[model samples]
Target: MVTRVTNQGPLTGVRVIELAGIGPGPFASMMLADLGADVVRVDRPGGGGFGAFPGDLLNRNRRSIAVDLKQPEGRDLVLDLVAGADALVEGFRPGVTERLGLGPDDCLAANPKLVYGRMTGWGQDGPLAQRAGHDIDYLALTGALHGVGRAGERPVPPMNLLGDYGGGGMMLALGVVAALYAVRGGAPGQVVDAAIVDGVSVLATQIHALRGIGLWQDPRGVNLLDGGAPFYDTYECADGRYVAVGALEPQFYAELVRLTGFPPDGGDGPQDAGAAAGGEALDRDDPANWPALRAAWARLFRTRTR
Candidate 1:
């Protein structure tokens, strides 16, 4: 078995095998490597794609070995490494690993305690599991895309932050770690299918819960956290610079109103974070409420400097 020295950290003794792809594969392995796991990435023989660069921070903290998986000996070499690894991470689509002869069964047979982490856009089994997609497509499918941006305008993509990293690599890393813990508890290792759609959807649980309780709206950008509530939105100043406000609670909203010169009452010096943000904090029926307060704050902020 081959080994590499890693700096001391929480996972100092752990070993991981990473099958290189793009995006999430390097990202997840980076997390493991960052925590001092001896993560070795198996790259393809030719270095055409975004292979490791000296300045590539995500590809840092780990070493890589290249092998041609098209050859039987190359695949055997990876399975040999898997025998000594505690976990494995890959971001290929559904059956790509099976065709490469390095699927879950192949790796698990090499090491029963292996945490097989599969990262994908749709998931292992789904209607569109085999379909090609990117971060934008995953975010669009998960309802996260619609909740960002302004009300009337088209929803702007939040880039790859939400899907590719937040939902993809981050979730896969968390799943692998959690599965490794389960293995330590005498549980058999299993597949962690961390799909971008599933992870993004899980990240939107709060919005779903709030909507279920009538505290949120189904329409995009018209809710409290979305661009709906004026107190919780961004406004442009006279200098053309924008400032975001999230005075949701009564006390903080009171401070927001006071600072913006749109006091709910006529006289206002300065309201503290503990002061009233609104009537009963979240009283929708309060007279100095949204429609009027929103307009008031909009006008007040427009008059101020950046």
Candidate 2:
């Protein structure tokens, strides 16, 4: 009989078996736990992951069991858990799980209805599938790394946020839910190859679409959203602090102009924002005027405090 865990969440009573790993895998399981799934993490005996952080929020909302996969008995323990679980998550690179005798086939055999989630930098089968890589390597290969940062400067990693959490972990969690949803419609269990490369690529959909329509450029910066426009970028204040502005729409930009003491146009204002900043007048829709606007905003911004 399946025990019902009441009052937790919409996912209450759902059981997930997570094979402990780092980064994306644990984060995915944490999302599962957050949604009220009864997630049981299988940590290696006396070999729990990344001992540096004790109060890891990722490990919360889930219980753990230690087992030695090197031992046949330990293998049996995980298989037994699989038989009673709704889904299983793992982040072993390529064939590591297969070598451990705990691949998708083994787990699926244990539970015919199981949704097996495999998280990796590359996918299950690709040119780079077997290549060892981390979040940076994956993001670099996916064109995402080339799309960030200030113009003419090196592209900055958004830390591991894009690859590990948003792209990999959150994508895996979404895939799990989607696979589980399919099972409700009489679909059989299947492997969810949640690759960080693939996930980050998906995150670039809008940019890709914009590029196709001649709106986005291939350079690191110099785009509407990626720190190209003055009104949409960060400014350093007088206190050595910074402030961000995102007046994307015309109305918002107008509001910003009205408030920041910048003129709405090169019109009859007492202080011409473009002239005072030693640049030509700026027209919002004219790409040629963007740099002038950026300079004007910068000059004004430097005069303010945080």
Candidate 3:
């Protein structure tokens, strides 16, 4: 029998209070819960009255408490809950929680050590912070969308993975955990301003480094890792599906040549027999040679498939 050992989690004793809205707030809470934290989600009365069942996986792994914050009793109820909580997460656009009388000031006044985590797109102080936006718009402002897609084509949106989940929600979770660590040694209460645009820019740090080192080109699909090198790209097979080829190093390229039956001694191998007859060897760096290589790979895949 294959045994899988499941150890007790790192956040087994941590407690978090989540003010439910949508997107990053619930996702951060779910990550905390997955690490064994006790996260309580405070939902609006009538159970998120604005929509249908919030069956999103991000909202799972937490207990829900419906309360009407418009009423004084509900405000007092949240204050009571805050008294025993370690952290609170909210994703309202800046002043919305303050208007609801449940902002960081209100919660921290009750619990001096509370770590308040705020999630948004443009941040807490920018002019567009209060304006409405989504993942694509946020990534567009950060130049992340421009770095994607092929050359001479419109920028392809990467389906909310970049801005909302990676930049907004995951960044907030990291901030909350860091704040908790800081507060363990007598650090006072604090707020984490996690903006999607800001985090997306931070996520581009490696690309920026590549640009500084002259490794990254201006145009998309014209760099080594960006589909410029024919050896480091995908090719269509005979079945019209695709297979990725990433033989960057010399040894890996040699292995790829051996496996594909290309030229082992700078001459053509069995795989490039047709091309060799035409006075051509498999040169992966040459884009003009891609068609021949692609045809050979297609023939190999076609013969193997039923």
Candidate 4:
């Protein structure tokens, strides 16, 4: 399995230091370790009192070191580790690392080639830089939450995957790798400011392109890819379960019609009583026709367990 294999290929000799936190930090470290980087997670004394199950895959492929940064001996030990390391990742809000005397400046002073990566919700400098926020807040600030859900419905959260993992953690890892490559030749000591808000905006690149075209609309549930296309959305199966429909293209639509045994010329289309009352075709684009189409599709699926 892709999840089980380690040391298979690539990133075999890379060294990375991860300052433990939550969400993005652990995810980023997991990716790095999966790709064969030797990642050492620096945890606080007594494991920071976080509740986590044993055998957590995120903490796998990594070694843990307990350190008390408040003490001079512990601080020296971390600096010593930095002296021979390639990169370091931290996910504290703005100035927390600097306050602990383990900031980029201090780490870079010890090892000039260190690629210091900082991950946070809001960035290193801004009005809300120091404020505590989570993934939903980050997505909200970046205009990502606005275009998320159905029309007239409340914005649905896409979990932490979008803001934390996609934007913050992945960006930090990429920045670290790029900086490491740059410093291998020259240009030592780089800092990567990876914020969840910034990363989410960067991820909106394709969405912006869709908006530039006439196909995308500002209103939610009216766009092609955002649950607006009736043919591309989920439908209720007869068992009260759900199945997705994706007859986007003509060929797929023909296949769907053939599979469902709908008439080729669109004749006798959807014999549902609701559609018969409306005198409409079972076309997905027509909202008034969806109820009928849904009923017909439900009847078809009811014969099968799925």
Candidate 5:
């Protein structure tokens, strides 16, 4: 068994053993360690599939120990460590830990008050739980990717932010904290099944609300919050740099219009918005005129330095 070290924070007294993996799992452990938990990462003999970089910021604020789980002694050593730990976080396939004899059952048996946190792409017991996936796959499956990008273009991948960190890691950290809190309140430690797919779906709660209210359309990049709105999207400046505009409110849009010196009410001169709608003026409120207004804004913004 490895020696324990005390840390300082809200979770100062908490102990966490992380079975080191990649991406979201490490990210979650980093958060726990940052919050004052004594997070000890268990790496394989060589490495944890990924090479170690001295500048790996994701694994900061944590200690690491290499253990050969294939060895009976090594497995026993981990179980011994689990006996004293407050939590164990693992991000493996559905049955990888079970096959290694360190599943939740094994850890919980060692410490009933232990919080067993599981991170995965799908979930613990879903149809695709055993399937291989990544952040992009989870985002695609959860309908999060479809809503991104321009109207006629393919969906733009938001890197791993949406699925790996935002959905998976953050959610896992939250669940672990909540579970640890429950243990402090005299509740038995439980497993936290944090799946990227599940979390991504939850992150789309507002999108779901928009859809239900009939304000959001099914197509991508055409909604008010999407790039469809002239005032809510980014524009290329004169210097070829892009500036993001999020003036969604009418007052903000009016201010934006005033500041840009683009003709007020979309005409050569200031005029009533209703009067300019029928003319060549770019009507900001009309969805049909979005392309035209966007063209106008693009032209206007291109004349200004970013």
Candidate 6:
């Protein structure tokens, strides 16, 4: 048995075993560690994670030890750690851990109250569960990538933010926390299968609802929140830097217009700051006037510094 020191936070007494991988799994463990869980990262011998970078922020707030899991000694060491842990996080294709004798069943047998959080690109039992994929691939399959970028341009990758961290890591962390809560309430600990594809789909719930209500279109960058609206996108400044615009509400848009000295209409018309952005001659509600408004905003923003 090894003694561990935990920091002061919401999860002060909780212990987590993070089987080192990359991206989402590391991020999930990072969140737990941030909340003051004593996260023990089990790395393979010779060190691991992001080219063994010492400053990998995702591996922060935790202790780490290298163990060669291919050998019985290493596997036994991990099982010993699992026996005392409240949760375990691992990100790999399905069956990888099972083959390594570190699967949920193995760890759960060692500690039945363990929250076995599994992070993957697909899922545990899906058709592509064992397939290789990255954040972009998961987003693409979940219709998230399709909605990004301009209407006429190819889908632009939103980096790994959506699938890897937001959808994947956040969901896994939430699931672990929820499972821990249940365990405290006398419920049995269980597996949390947080697949990036499923998580990204859940993240797009608003878009699905909008599509169901006919308020959203199927094409990219043609919706109210998908950069189709002139007031909801970014514009370039004179310094070649870009600024994001999210003045969705009328008052906010009016404030934006006031601050930027922008004319609502393309011409030098009366600045109806009190007009609702959803209606009136503000032209914000009309899709036909979007091109002109976008052009005018573009021209105006180009005159600003940043």
RMSD of each predicted structure: 4.0, 3.9, 5.3, 4.7, 3.5, 2.9
lDDT per residue (tens digit) for residues 1-306 in model 6: 224455789999999999999999999999999999999998877774453587778878888888998998999999999999999999978998999999999999999999999999889886888788888899988889999899999999998899999999999999999999999999987899998988899999999999999999999988899999998999999999999999999788877876666775565444445442323455678888898889888988887788
Please give, for residues 29-133, the per-residue lDDT of candidate 3 as tens digits: 888888877888888877653322646677777788888888889888888888899999998888988988889999999999999999999999867978988
Better of 3 and 5 by TM-score: 5
Least lDDT summed over 10 consecutive residues: which range in candidate 5?
271-280
Please tell me which model should have the higher lDDT, number 3 or number 5.
5
Off by over 4 Å in 2: 1-7, 48-52, 264-281
Candidates sorted by lDDT, best first: 6, 5, 2, 1, 3, 4
Weakest lDDT window of 10 consecutive positions for candidate 4: 1-10
Q: What's the residue-level lDDT of 177 in candidate 1?
A: 91
lDDT of 1 by residue, 1-306 (tens): 234465678888899988888887789999999998988888787655744555677777777898898799999999999999999999888999999999999999989999999999998887999998899999998879988887788888987889989999999999999999999899997899899998899889998999899888666777777777876878888899998988778667656654544545332334343343343233433433666656656676777898
lDDT of 4 by residue, 116-160 (tens): 888888888989998988889999989898888987798899977
Error of 6 at 52 (Å): 4.7
RMSD of 2: 3.9
Q: For model 1, what is the error of residue 72's alpha carbon versus the real structure, in angstroms, after optimal superposition?
A: 1.8
The C-alpha local distance difference test score for the whole of candidate 5 amounts to: 0.86
Task: Give one digit per residue, the lDDT tens place, for model 2 in 1-306.
Answer: 122333288778888999889999999988888888999888887755553166777778888787898899998889999999999999988888888889999999998899999899888887888887788888888889998798999999888899988889999999998998897688888788898988999999999999999998888668889988777899898888999999999778766776666744443345644443443246776777887777767777778797
Name the candidate that leads on lDDT.
6
TM-score each candidate.
0.85, 0.90, 0.84, 0.86, 0.90, 0.92
Clashing pairs in model 3, backbone N/Cα/C closer than 3 A: none
lDDT of 2 at 175: 95
| Candidate 5 Cα misplacement greater than 4 A, ranges | 1-7, 48-52, 267-283
Clash pairs for candidate 1: 250-277, 254-277
